[model samples]
Target: MATQLIELVDGPLDTGKPSKPKFRTVRKDGQIVKLRIVDADSPNFSADLTASFQANIRRARKENREIEDDS
Candidate 1:
């Protein structure tokens, strides 16, 4: 299976004195999935981004299981 990446819609997290991590999602075939959190809050903030990410994760998990079965 090929790796899938869900681009984060959020601009960027605020990484100043008190920095909040930015959020991103990644799906790898044989590697552990990872969330890329950066800093730099952008004006473009979408709630769906987070929601979609959750949904993508659920789907990826199912896909992963199937891949394992194939192996």
Candidate 2:
């Protein structure tokens, strides 16, 4: 059995009002597994989210036995 992960990222457009990075994770079964929001003040929100997403995928893969990312 194999599972995949996906992340949906979004953010506020207003620069003055900083908001957390919006993202969601899904499995190969097309089920949403998790949602994460990075710090709004962080300068490297994109990088942080990307890293976190990768880590999550790795962890999920290890725990699920095997995961194939479709993202």
Candidate 3:
């Protein structure tokens, strides 16, 4: 299975700081999974999360294609 990076964001907590970007890597298995953010309370939480997820998906796909081409 190909490895993929999943980007995520950590929203500001009660301290009221800005959001911080985060990432995780996982194998690209042919299965869907659920992600649960325990306590995200940012105004742009959904938008930020969606953007990060899509960006990482594109990035992972591109990287995988490059690796395949090299083989």
Residue 34 of model 1, lDDT score = 56
Candidate 3 per-residue C-alpha lDDT over 4-38 given as tens digits, one digit per residue, 9 for 90 to 100: 99967688434333356554444458655444342
Query: Each candidate: what lDDT?
Result: 0.58, 0.64, 0.62
Choose 2 or 3, whichever is better by TM-score: 3
- Candidate 2 differs from the real structure by a C-alpha RMSD in angstroms, to one decimal, of 16.4
Flag regions of model 1 displaced more than 4 Å.
1-45
lDDT (10s digit) by residue, model 1, range 1-71: 99999878678654333234455567688776657453335443344345445567898999999999999
TM-score of each: 0.34, 0.38, 0.43
CA shift of 26, model 2, Å: 22
Q: For model 1, where is the 10-residue window of minimal lDDT?
A: 13-22
Model 1 whole-model lDDT (C-alpha atoms): 0.58
Candidate 3 C-alpha error for residue 18, in Å: 13
Candidate 2 C-alpha lDDT tens digits along 1-71? 89989866687433343334477787868776776667746877666666667668888878677444432
